[model samples]
Target chain A: MNTFMGYERPNGDIGIRNHLLIIPTVICSNQVCSRIMQLVPGTVAIPHQHGCSQIGADKERTFEVLAGTGKNPNVGGVIVISLGCEVVDPYALADDIRKTGKPVEVFDIQSVGGSVKAIKHGTELARRMLEELERQPKVPIPLSRLKVAVKCGGSDATSGLASNPALGAAADALIAAGGTVVIGETTEIIGAEHVLAQRCATPDTAERLYHIVGRFEREVERMGADMRGGNPSPGNIEGGLSTIEEKSLGCISKCGKAPIKGVIEYAERLPEGGLYFMDSPGNDIECVSGMAAGGVHIVCFTTGRGTPTGAAVVPVIKITGNKRMYDRMEDNMDVDVSAMLEGAMSLESAGERIWQEILEIADGKWTKSETLGHQEFSINRIGPSL
Target chain B: MKQQIADGVDALIMDNRDHVATVLREIMSGDTVRYRDDHGIREITAIDLIPFGHKIAIEVLDTGDDVCKYGEIIGRACFAILVGQHVHVHNIEGIRGRGDRAGKAGT
Candidate 1:
């Protein structure tokens, strides 16, 4: 069994990278979080327009996503800053993260006097947390302890042909090694759900799979519209896809042929082993963010077109099978499996290549997105902002 | 080998269901073709104007007939479909189950 060297967290999770995360409880505190992250070297803060004016499930979703992100194994420690009057409580958020056994500190701008005062207090706590995190050491961890999330964006014809299938092979390889793999984008799976259901371990799991698809359809129906008009984007059509089912059939290929053990909600903790499904929207950034918050240490994103998106903590490995697009966006991409289409490479060969890349990345080799400083972050909002 | 059509676009082969060949390209009228009793791809000589990503109705399909593509039934044809034509929003519709609630309404 292969293994990689990584930092062993006090909470029993192995982390590929030790990241110091700065979180804001409200959109109002984003500036402060950004300021602190800038002032303190090696600290990363997520800036987003959420955490306020949300009601019911929407507000809870924000809170859960925030806490889950902070608690992700990749994060060594966290510094949570709040506006004091937001819907999400800063102290509670800090407590939730502290459960991970990492260093956690919280401060409210209103309670700490103001921006200047809050920054001052935040700087002190951030410095302390960073110092403590720096004290942690790396340990040898099995590859099976690692979880990778598979995603795709800006898809094209070559996606299903070269990139996604290659990703599927890689996903199967990881699962064979006893490592966990997760695939999401429920909207993209619309046409191929039945095929996936057939691969479910049992009848109940199959039923559960159908339930997820039904839920999304009903939700769309509630919006008083039909998906017949749109699901495959203009880009998908231009790239040669005609319907949602057509696009979905190709999209579902990334999951490979592993038995789906369970289906989980967005940003929820994944199952122990094998392939799992996370319920996430098709928006690239939001889906990736949800996976990160769900505790995935790395993301394996396959694209036929291209996107430059990275998470604050986890490393994102961008793979593509479109030779032209790969060359066009070499800076943003890491693995190019286009040779599979050209017949120079086999699917298993491509999968082996990706698995090697995963090992190197886990050992601290920065992905193209990370080196380019593409730390794009966004949370999917459930309802309209008021 | 078990071959299933993920859709009308990609053809997938596994070990379980090897009886039928899935559709790799869309078929149209005036096109000649041969496939399993389920479905087959025909060459478009006259090009009867089929949508690129949509499925083509290869043979007579009953209401409960499993719509085959990539060697597997992606869905059940909601209505009867004619042979050698297009199959998509016009004929096939999805049936979702309960657990698919993580993303937005549509793909």
Candidate 2:
């Protein structure tokens, strides 16, 4: 059996990484949380501008992403810090993460006194968690247990021509090996949704796919704005993507040819062992963050124009079909498949190269994004904060 | 067997059903570019100075015809286009995400 060394969590999930995550329950707690992460080595922090003034589904989304990040199999333990008066229930969030059978602790900055005192308290707690996390043993786990997310950003024509399709081939290989793959960026799938809808495992799945796309379109319509104004962004247009449809056609190719098992909401816990599609925004950091919150162990991000985005908890492997961009942004890119266009490399070979990179990363090799300290995290918000 | 030309391949046609091909390298006007697809190697003369990664019409298209690439309709030709002409925002209009252009044939 093909296997990679991973941290086997008590919940029976295999984690390619063992991280001590520091989470801020509200925007007010960001400074304290950041201070703790800065004070403690081997700890990661996700500080977002949310958790307060959000109502209904929006509030639930913030809570879900926060709790989900803590519950990710990659996290050995979590320390949630909150402002005592925030709308989000920090204790409830901690309880949710604790259900994963991992150690979870929560504290409030106001309750601990203030910034200075809270920073000290959080740092001590984070240090203890990191020490415990460092003691966790790594065990060999079947590669079939891994869940990977596929995404593309800063895309150009070469993304469609080479990298995305090569990534697709790799995605297919992982699925065939019994792993799970999730693809997102609903807006990016606008033109090519019909193609994806056809790949749904069931008629209901197909209908849900169309429904989410339609809902996103109607939401954009409600704002009396054109999605084209934001999508096929200026950089995308300069990179030779003429329309949203052209961009979508290329974007959808990264998930490979597997039948989409299901369509899921953003930050929703993914089902096991197949290809799934998550409805998400096309923004680079936000999309990757959602996948991280959805419990993906790694993200394969294809870029043509180049971007340096990574997730707070997930390792991002940046692949680019633009050799020029890769050369220019070598510090940010992980794999360069541009040779496929030159005929020096074949698509299948490129896919194999990426698959090997995935296995190596899963086995504890650091990616460019991870080494560069690009732990970017953001939540997609649906409504304005009060 | 057909001879496989290794050099001077400046563009790629992803599918036989595609109406457009993407230029892999910059091509000056009047330059002959060779592209390969499943059908085999074919050549077209560039009518415009096509930049790298941009599309060139592989088939002539009338106004309002769907422009296909990757064997899928990507957009609609906004005006008459001849083979080898650059196909982009100037001649091809996106059929999706444009609130004003909704309900088009491809949408």
Residue A264 of model 1, lDDT score: 86
Q: Give the residue spans of candidate 2 off by over 4 A.
A: B1-7, B101-107
Chain A TM-score of prediction number 1: 0.97
Best candidate per TM-score, number?
A: 2
TM-score of chain B of each: 0.47, 0.85
lDDT of 1: 0.76
lDDT of 1 by residue, A1-386 (tens): 38788998878988998889999999999999999988898889998899999888888888888998898899999989999998888899999999889888888899899999898888888888888888888888998898999998888666776678888888898898899999998888887888888888878878877888877867766665555445666565555454566568778878788999888899898777899989888888899999999999999998876788888778999998778778899999999997765456778888888888988998889999989877788888887787
DockQ of each: 0.13, 0.47
Per-residue lDDT, model 2, residue A163, is: 93
lDDT of 1 at A44: 91
C-alpha positional error of residue B65 in candidate 1 after TM-score superposition, expressed in Å: 12
CA error at residue A178 for candidate 1, angstroms: 1.3
Q: In model 1, what is the error at residue A263, expressed in angstroms?
A: 1.2
TM-score of each: 0.82, 0.96
Which structure among the candidates has the greatest lDDT? 2
